[model samples]
Target: MLKSEFAKTFAMLATGLSCVLMAQNTLADAPEHRIINLQAEATREVANDEMQATLYTELNEKDAATLANKINSIVNQAMNTAKSYPKVEIKTGGQNTYPVYNDKQQLVNWRGRAEVILNSQDFKQTSELIAKLQESMQLGNINFEVSAEQRNKVESELYIEASKAFQQRAKLLLAPWGASNYELVNLQLNANANRPMPIYAARDASFKADSIESQNIEAGNSEITVIANGSIQLK
Candidate 1:
């Protein structure tokens, strides 16, 4: 009787151990939580608040020293004139001098070109300055852009809108599956701006310095976009 009882107890313990091992294996084989990926974007058009203009001058001289002096003179005069408009930002741009080669590949004369760039939030001032500079320098191009501060503010607002849109889409997608809750697995945000091409026009060197007119510029719209990408695990 003692031996029979001991055998029965051992059999019960073995059965319990086997059941525990099977439960563990089942848990291990079960698939991980499922997730759905989603993306949403928002765009806003805002008026450009900044202006940039590039003006350049070219000179051809038989002597290199004379060419450099002339270029420096013109650039200095332009810089001084720009200082009068305290609101405008001025900076010197590319200055290049290269030797002109004849058919025989011998260096003949030297040609030099210098550029000055101006930027400002005040469109009127910037345009007028460019017109004045045309007396000595040629107009390269004019560009309009949205200021950094304004762009940042607009992007911040769009980010919120895009995130909300993403969440709404996720909920709508999961509604049919009878899943009303989700866990955000990962998310990403991106911001971008669409800048228009620079405006080009014929050099207005014909206009007299005294009669130079201030240009009336229209600040076009810049389209700012923000996108949100994320994966959510439905609960």
Candidate 2:
């Protein structure tokens, strides 16, 4: 009888210890009904401070080398012309050469295109360079965006504002719940740009190199929004 009683007591103690460890692990995360979701956002419209444009010269020839040479010559001239605009940055974009197929499926000739890209903060200078280059190469596309420096500055400011707003809202909500304080269980910060996209009449026959003139451009605006989304546990 003594041996049986001792065995039963040890079994009970071991079972209790296992249950305690399991309960502790289960409660490691926040308890039910203790978590609350909150979200705050701040937004600002900033003028687009940068521009990028692509120009390309396409040609066809009996030989691939001849086509490439013609395309390269036109692009080199375009880059050289862009050098006149000190504020604009000019770089080679891409060059592609492919075989041209005839009605008989014969690879009769080679078609190629050499491209150049222009980047600048000065819209006037960029437009002028585009007009000059358009005299040779055709305009491909144009895009406007906020510069990196300005974007970073605006996003930093908005993050602080959004975080503070989130904290304030949390405190206000807790006051109604009769809770003295709350814990920040999780937080997520995000930013997105809502801006109008620039449209261009690229590759249109009406926009031929000989008929095109200086382009009118607008910098427009981009809305930079920062959102603070998170959940907090009531204390």
Candidate 3:
């Protein structure tokens, strides 16, 4: 019985020693200094293809119902006016109502605001629609951005360029590292865009329908960027 126990203990110790030796050999074979991180970026200026604009009206009255009716009437008219431009998308939601207090802090009246938002890719149609709505509703703001389909198309092209740039850079770096070749350990790609909101040059909201005219607009451009981040093992 004692001999059997001694044999088992000796076998376990031998296995543990073998594992430690194998780990040490692996560490010796791996050159930690041979691995390097690399990054490459590509950018392009793309024309903005999408636009979003807001129009709203605010009114105050002693009666909440009357105030709501007036606000709703203005927004409804704006919505009806927008329907003429089928190419543009329209919606309404920014309805807000709050109490108004006089100097004595007494609830004297109610004030309410309603909004209509417009989204579209057809800049000309949207511009015309904005002109029509400005006759009744006040312009909140207008901004442009790259649409999803356009952004995806741009990103696909950028990735191709960014990947090639990374490879060229990696190949150029091999000589400095004293390596004739390298193997890609890992790779990652990312996309981003730099877009700034454009201000709308709006006139008085009370302008007559005939007085308001379609103004020329320039969406400008956005800078789209793609980056390639990776690690390479030199050989």
Candidate 4:
């Protein structure tokens, strides 16, 4: 073979090898880092299947002992009356005695306030008990609440929803940067319940007769909001 031809052959082989090396390096050196961030929120409405109410009864007694007995009878009767509702849980509550002051700052009489809280899973039953308690022990204000079981279930669903939203956001953010593949490095979930307004007027027994009517009670929707945050990496 001629020396020139041999040299030309070697040059051609070197050029092909260089092209292969360059292509391999380009693939390996593809984008190594990218910015991917996402945010999401979720909400759910739950019906309040449970109910709570604070019932107060005030009595005026000439003697402490007699007043105690009288107040006890009123509370006991009210509690027992509440038991008539198969779904209601009746429990004894407050007992207090204080001196009543007159306009001249003189002791007019002894005032005793007795009370109990009625809790039930049945909304209608709870409402009826509150109304009837007023006729007897003079029902006080009624505050509403949700059961523990229901709240936990709602919160779990909310968390799942929030996680889905975060994932969607991360995908959207990464799409523009040419990165759609990612794994959740970390995830956090938070949730809470808000208390309902207190019923102060229910404590007023000035018109027990008028209060006999079932209090117009509406168990408003409880909001469960879930927030999830996590870091994602895309290539």
Q: Which one wins on lDDT?
A: 1
Model 4 TM-score on a 0 to 1 scale: 0.70
- Please state the error at residue 98 of candidate 2 in Å: 0.2
Clashing pairs in 2: none
Off by over 4 Å in 4: 1-38, 101-108, 177-180, 194-196, 202-217, 233-235
TM-score of each: 0.85, 0.82, 0.83, 0.70
How large is the C-alpha RMSD of every model relative to the true structure? Answer: 4.6, 4.4, 4.6, 9.7
- Pick by lDDT: 1 or 3, better one: 1
TM-score of candidate 1 on Cα atoms, chains taken together: 0.85
Which residues of candidate 1, in runs, are more than 4 Å off? 1-25, 28-32, 204-214
Sort the candidates on lDDT, descending order. Answer: 1, 3, 2, 4
Clash pairs of candidate 1?
none
- What C-alpha root-mean-square deviation, in Å, does candidate 3 show against the real structure? 4.6
Better of 3 and 4 by TM-score: 3
Which model, 1 or 2, shows the larger lDDT? 1
Please report how far candidate 1 places residue 39 from its true position, in Å. 0.6
Off by over 4 Å in 2: 1-33, 203-216
Across residues 128-225, which tens digit of lDDT does each residue of candidate 2 receive? 77777777778888889999999999999999999999999999988778788999989999998886676564466244444345345667899999
Candidate 1 lDDT trough over 10 residues, lowest sum: 206-215
Provide the overall lDDT of each model, using Cα atoms, as 2-decimal numbers: 0.89, 0.85, 0.87, 0.76
